[model samples]
Target chain A: EADIYQTPRYLVIGTGKKITLECSQTMGHDKMYWYQQDPGMELHLIHYSYGVNSTEKGDLSSESTVSRIRTEHFPLTLESARPSHTSQYLCASSDFYEQYFGPGTRLTVT
Target chain B: AQSVAQPEDQVNVAEGNPLTVKCTYSVSGNPYLFWYVQYPNRGLQFLLKYITGDNLVKGSYGFEAEFNKSQTSFHLKKPSALVSDSALYFCAVRDGEVVNFNKFYFGSGTKLNVKP
Candidate 1:
């Protein structure tokens, strides 16, 4: 199993609340990515990091921001959550050719 | 830029029958292909990958994929289907030659339903 993990596997929050989805990996991979997915839909890349102190926005535009202060941790934060932001967020770490994923965080904004 | 295509939106197969989920890709250089399966309310799980050497690569959960260079296809296959195998499958591609190339493009996805 992949060592990557996402906290609060399920999250329910009110609109306008600030939230951070934590993603950590013990694999010590240099490349990490965050993807947003909806039910039965394709995953949309939201953010990624090549290494510590490096981050980039992905193809899909998202309001959330990310930080890569530590090699093992890549956390995504939303300044203000909204119902439109409700979706499943996936974290993955790459080991050369393949990317291993976490269980994912399902966010429900009310 | 790299891109992946999953032509079918859904595939239905009876239990004990064989199954195939089609995928095609485009890339500037040789492609690194991958197959990932997502269960309900869960993140994607790596099923298999094709880097080089073999045209056929086996992966977790009795899943396998055949890589066709001429057609640029890496289709996921299973000899027999099970109801528990029903899930969403995604195909992805990335350029292997590019150094520090981080983009991994994915297909829309194919939903597989194994009816019991």
Candidate 2:
């Protein structure tokens, strides 16, 4: 049972609205990642953090920005949401090899 | 560049029969392979991993994966399939030799359907 949690398991917002997805883990892992996934599709890494104050962009280009001010918390914020931004956002923390994932946030931009 | 591939988009099996999900990977250095399962609308759950020790690694829910260096494959297997086992499966690989070794490449998911 991983202690990772993501808020707003499902979110529906109008286009152009600003929104933030919160991710937290109690395991004190140094490595955290944010991935975007379409329904039943391949995962696209969007953002990751090596540790507090260390954030890096992943392979896929994303409009979202992430911050790692605290080791256990890594939140992603979109300045202006769009219909193209509709997808599931997954947060995970890794301990060397294995990654533990949160429940994920499903976002819909109408 | 490091990458993971799951050739099959979906696999169907009968209950009580065996099941196999194919995975292949390409990496510059030693490959760290892993398998994860995801139920509908849920996040991925780690199934098993191939680090270094054994070619055959057993994981939760009676799942196992065999790592073949010659084939550059780490395929997930289960002796007996269950209806409850139906889900989306993902294969991931991390290159040990990369400067940013923390990054992992994930394969397109394979949907498993177990018919009773």
Candidate 3:
């Protein structure tokens, strides 16, 4: 199994509340990525990091920001959560050609 | 540009029967293809990947994929289906060129239903 973990498998917060989704891996992978997905739907890349201190936005535009302070940790923060932001957030770390994914965080904004 | 396409939204198969999920891709450079399976409300599990060499690549859980460069297709296959195999499957492609190697384009996903 992949050594990646995502905190708070499920989350529900009120609108306008700030939230941070935590993702970490013990694999020491240099490439980390965050993707937003709806229930049983297509995945949209929101943010990714090539390595520590190297973050980049993905093809899809997102309001969330990410920081890669440590090679193992890549956290995403939404300044103000809206109902539209409610979706599953997945964290992944890649090595060579394959990517291993975390359990994922399902967020709900009410 | 890099992109992946899964023609079927869902594929239905009976237990003990063969199953196939189709995927096609487009990339500016050589293609690196992957197949991932996701259970309901869970993270995606890496099934298999095709980097180079042989056209057919075998992977975990008795799964395999054929990489067809001529058709730009990478289709997932299983000799016999099992009920436990029911889930959502995604096909992803990455460009092999140096500049865009890290980026992966994913298909919309195909739901696999294996009936008993």
**What are the C-alpha RMSDs, in order, of all predicted structures?**
1.1, 0.7, 0.7
**Worst lDDT window (10 residues) for model 2 chain A?**
A94-103
Which regions of candidate 3 are displaced past 4 Å?
none
Alpha-carbon shift of residue A102 in model 1 (angstroms): 0.8
Give the per-residue lDDT of model 3 (tens digit) for B1-116. Answer: 68899999999999999999999999988888999999988999999999889999999999999999999999999999999999999999987778778988899999999999
Question: DockQ of candidate 2?
Answer: 0.90
Q: Model 1, A20-109: lDDT tens per residue?
A: 999999999999999999988998999999999999999999999999999999999999999999999999999788898999999999
Candidates ranked by lDDT: 2, 3, 1
By lDDT, the best candidate is 2
Clashing residue pairs found in predicted model 3: none
TM-scores of chain B, in order: 0.95, 0.97, 0.97
Give candidate 2's whole-model lDDT.
0.96
lDDT per residue for candidate 1 within B30-95, as digits (tens), equals 888999999898888888888889899999999999999999899999999999999999999976
Check candidate 2 and list the clashing pairs. none
Q: What TM-score does model 1 achieve against the real structure?
A: 0.97
